[model samples]
Target: MNGHFPWLTVMAAVPFAGALAVAVLPAAKRTLAKNLALLVTLVELVLAIIVTVKFSPDGDRFQMTESYAWIKSFGVHWSLGVDGIGVVLILLTAVLMPILILASWHDADGPQVRMDGTAGESAAPRSTHAFFALMLAVEAMVVVSFAATDVFVFYIFFEAMLIPMYFLIGGFGGAQRSYAAVKFLLYNLLGGLVMLAAVVGLYVTTADHDLAGPGQGTFDLARIAQAVSTGELHISPGAEKAMFLGFMFAFAIKAPLWPFHTWLPDTMTEATPGVAVLVTAMVDKVGTFAMLRFCLELFPNASKTFAPLVITLAVIGIIYGALLAVGQTDIKRLIAYTSISHFGFIIMGIFALTSQGHSGATLYMVNHGFSTAALLLIAGFMITRRGSKTIADFGGVQKVAPVLAGTFLVAGLATLSLPGLAPFVSEFLVLVGTFSRYQAAGIVATVGIILAALYVLVLYQRTMTGPVKAGVEKMRDLNVRELVVVAPLLALLLVLGVYPKPILDVVNPAVDDTLSQVEKTDPKPAHPIQAPVEQAAAVTPLGGNK
Candidate 1:
């Protein structure tokens, strides 16, 4: 069933097809476009599921690869493949796309939520189709960003994403939509430009190594990875460091790591609830994805050299984001801040460069996507009912809307990496791996877990446990439709936590492959600094070695 057609290609094409169909239709037929988009997303999800089932975990490399000449003269190709790591993320993206579309279905219905807790009516703007179109576009771009094997293709998909997202925010977002859109675009553009410079540098360096002048050089990531691994390619330490920073800066900003993360709260605050879910829960993941794919795999030596600095920033972000989250009054904004803190754990795990760390980071990305989506979606519904995003505006939501409250608790538990939730296993693995390799950094990162518990529990207590606030008293529980949308995420959060072997079986091999490459391109020192320092004083007291 899988081999008959290029399922991956079809999956990539579905949304584009939907977009084109929607674009040509008259504004009167916007509903058709929206329906088509929903269909396309469902189809993509099914394809992803099939791909997942058929994927061979034993393969240990990219599978179902599809390659063709894109720009032959300069060695640019349209290549797509998914390793175990990429496959899960792709599946995550696919799964979320349909759910988000469903979640957003009510946005364009009409602006008329009654104070009596009745469903509201929105203005009959053509925005329903427009918003869905942009989401599909973003979905396509994000999938490509994950699946692309060519650096140039990856870069284009990476940057092309901002356009749809900008429109999603600016066109369909809240009152401050324009401001949020501009800020989101500008910050991401800056990072993209930096990444562009690094991408060009990679090709230039590769060209010189291959002795192919100008555009004659190739930009195949696998070929380059092999070259760098085998010493067939030589990138100077300074160049490596510069390129690494360029890529890291871009990804870190996208990951919204601490200082570079200011754009997130503003963007989330101004975005439609659905758009907020996609951006915070999904799009931001591309940054961490890039970190694992490019920074560690392509420039291992630089990654190793910069590990201490990266780890420092990660820990600071963990604490800083948590502090900021605790201070946030807006529920959406608080979740955005919490995402920054969670990403810190992911970045810490990646830089830790251990098998468990990398594997955990992969799983964390998947788990966070589901958890964030669940939380944001629930929050969105709450806002729709109450007409406010401020936590202080409502209370005793559990008493009024027990189903919504329960979902919130489930999602929050996952966010905090509770022991029985999906993120728990990944977060624990990350910490364990980090402790094994960088004890101090690992220990500091544990504080992030504590902070996560604090934020998630506090958020729940504020919104759900208090006495029913004036406006929230009559709110209804989640309807069957909403429950249908969130049910899978909750089930997976528990199922994966209980039995992670399914994902780990596939992910560990890829992590091992990446670590092997990292070791080759950037071998560890005979004695890591921390290991020696700990033993140094003891050895000195023993009069040194004989």
Candidate 2:
């Protein structure tokens, strides 16, 4: 797969090319731009499926790899590859793009006037071409980030993605969109700066150790990780810990873990639902994925050293986010808080240092993407119809729009990790995995589940169950297009929930490899189980046992 064809490059290039084409289309050709973008995404989806089918889970750790020299001076290369984890995430990105494009068809068509009769600075009629183009650009960057095997290549796209997302939020969002956009940019830029220092530090360390050659340095992730694992590239414990902190700081902000998470709710609250989904479901995932790919593999000793602290932060975020969600009155903000909690579970699982934890964290990323997309997109539709983001603005929505309410309920249930929904299986694995290693943290995290049910059911009851509010009388059911968006997401949630083996089969081997890189093994039980014959003998009377 590596030498045969440039599969990963083509996968990323198609969307990038489509974005440029869409961006340059004339204003009058909005429909043409939209359709072109959708077609590009669909093609990307097909390519992703082909890659997945061709990827052998039992085969090499990284398949479909492509590499070329880009910056030979610093030992940089234009490299790309995919393991099971990368393939699934790429698939997730592809599946969401066209659907989000459809959901956002009219989002940029006109200005959004405020209640005060004044359109804000950002409320001018936006270019529909730019909106869809930015989305495609985001898809391109995210896909590249997932497939990139070069540390420098990953860093470039990881930071480059902010440009499109900033425009998506500020240029096409709510009254306070500018503030949200700036906050989002500044927060991420700060993290990227810290990570830049770490990236430089890593190259310096490699040069000092002469891992690549007598004097050359390398930014190839696989090459460096191999050296680290074989003990050929020895970084001092203190330096490794510092570099790990630098990388972890950026990822935590991107993961938007607590203390660093203040930016997410505001960004989600201000941006359109589709853009919000891109941020949380797609962009943010690169953070946690990098934790597995870079932090653990490249600095195994440091990863183990920091696992306890990271898990503690994760537990706090879980309870903290759920508690805040219970109190939010804005529908979008509430959902944003819930994402923080879900991310907490993901981070916890990753640091739990077991195969189950790693697999669950990986699967949770995919499941959360679909579940959050379904919920946020449906909420966007509701907000559009009602002209309010406040939860109290609508009541008995089910009375007039039964289908919308029903679907909303389903999405909400999935968010709370209800059984038979995609998120449940992942959340259960996170807990089971965490409990096996860190029992107290796992117990505290379960409180998030209880709090999750509280917020979701309360949100539903208040908005859907009461008598119809004054302005809700003319509300309509989900039209054909809206149903198209919601139906597949709901179907995936159901199908994945009942049978997660397909995803697990792909993820487990990768998990094992990660554990091996970190030199971790699952802990043995304190109380060992007796053999079948021993148990039978113990249960039988002395004479009857013979």
Candidate 3:
């Protein structure tokens, strides 16, 4: 936006610094740690907002870039920058952090005595510091992962994110924390390893190609993109598809689309709601984000070659996830399945390769985060009251806590693409865009919306309606603290639902740029040929009386 500024670097580092501060501060001083973490994230949010405000969508794809030599042996650079796409996603990451900190305040720092029964008061805060710290650390990784202009740099951040989230579940979750944490870690770790293999291939391939009239290709994505743009570097069809599949495998698992989604419901169900929100709303976004940023950008031919297969999987994930969600008894698990369904739409939009679809996919990432945050946080509140995530455990909740029920319902409606809600706008654009290319895929995917309404309304009906269940009469309405946590998200959804132009104005340009990189467009529909003597010459229908 201006002269060389390290704003991107600062935005990424602030969270890490905050985590370090939390780690070194007296563990017993829980309030200090919480306050410090909150302050750090707030400051990061402020910086992110400032940078976003300064970001002119019409400007260069990468803005406020910062580059430095790193691991020069193979020609890597610690480069950072943001296009409109990266800027918005970075904003999503920053925006969610402060809210999550607020949400976790009670859950992570509540009045629970130590299980060991030794200095219970202090232990609650001390243990929770790790939770907050890890969250912030994950935020830092997300910022860098999105903003990194270097391919290798992105890979580092990509794998780096799993560490904090791994501990967040295993360290401070439910009775099955260890099992859930291991499963989550193992799945992501394996995906990362596969991605690493691809990264290594690119490293060697770029080197051998002697790109840029030079000895070896650099890891800077900008440079590689430039080489390809100018026709200086060429990839064989086989190599392109191999690398594409490598990247796709990792992202698909992360997006947890269809078959790759088994780890998700388990992780979301076992994770604390705060962690669940972080993982589902933000972390899972990395999958689709990488698809747009790397897979398509770097391997355009392979992307086109595999578009049909990918779209089929996306459509399948949509229907499959929605169906499973409708049958889920656990509310948290249900929400997780819903995200898998939503991700199907996001991926479908991206592969549609239409300007509108990619734009909607980008916006979907932001809207999905907000809507998911509202649902998970409100669900968190409900679970805290009932001490259960089972849908059957709740009934007549709206009578006892009107505000909670209302907010939860609004969030659920948004998830189901209710009009006048944030998600509806993006979801609409995605379908409109996809229909232009493949009507059948778009139509099949739309079926998921009906299933979405079924699952959400049914969950609401089961949990918040009917006579107050046993002990539900005592459940309190949303307190100011809880209201504070969800209000901003609702406000965002409402404003965006009404006027998404501000985001789209920025998003469309990036989408166009991405489509250009992929060198693909929506194939026009076929028009049947007409004959001069059409009526008499045309083939008659099977049952027609000739």
Candidate lDDT scores, in order, read: 0.84, 0.93, 0.88
lDDT of 1 by residue, 321-434 (tens): 888888888999999888888888889888988887888989999988888888888898898899888889988999989889999999999988999989999999888878
Worst 10-residue lDDT window for candidate 1 reads: 111-120
Which scores higher on lDDT, 1 or 2? Answer: 2
- Measured against the true structure, the TM-scores of the candidates, in listed sequence, are 0.91, 0.97, 0.93
Model 2 per-residue lDDT tens digits across residues 1-546: 345889999998999999999989888998899899889999999999999999999999999899999988999999999999999999999999889998998888877545343576775567899999999999999999999999999999999999999999988888788889999999999999999999999999999888778888899899899999999899999999999999999999999888799999999999999999999999999999999999999999999999999999999999999999999999999999999999999999999998888999999999999999999999999998988989999899999999999999999999999999999999999999999999999999999999999999999999998899988889888999999999999999999999999999998898999899999999889999999998977785767644
Query: Judged by lDDT, which candidate is best?
Result: 2
Candidate 2 TM-score to native: 0.97
lDDT accuracy of residue 425 in candidate 1:
94
Lowest-sum lDDT 10-residue window in model 3: 111-120
RMSD, candidate 3, Å: 5.3
lDDT of 3 by residue, 481-540 (tens): 889999999999999999999889877778888898888765665875576789566767
What C-alpha RMSD separates each model from the true structure? 5.9, 1.7, 5.3
Q: Flag regions of model 3 displaced more than 4 Å.
A: 1-3, 110-126, 523-546
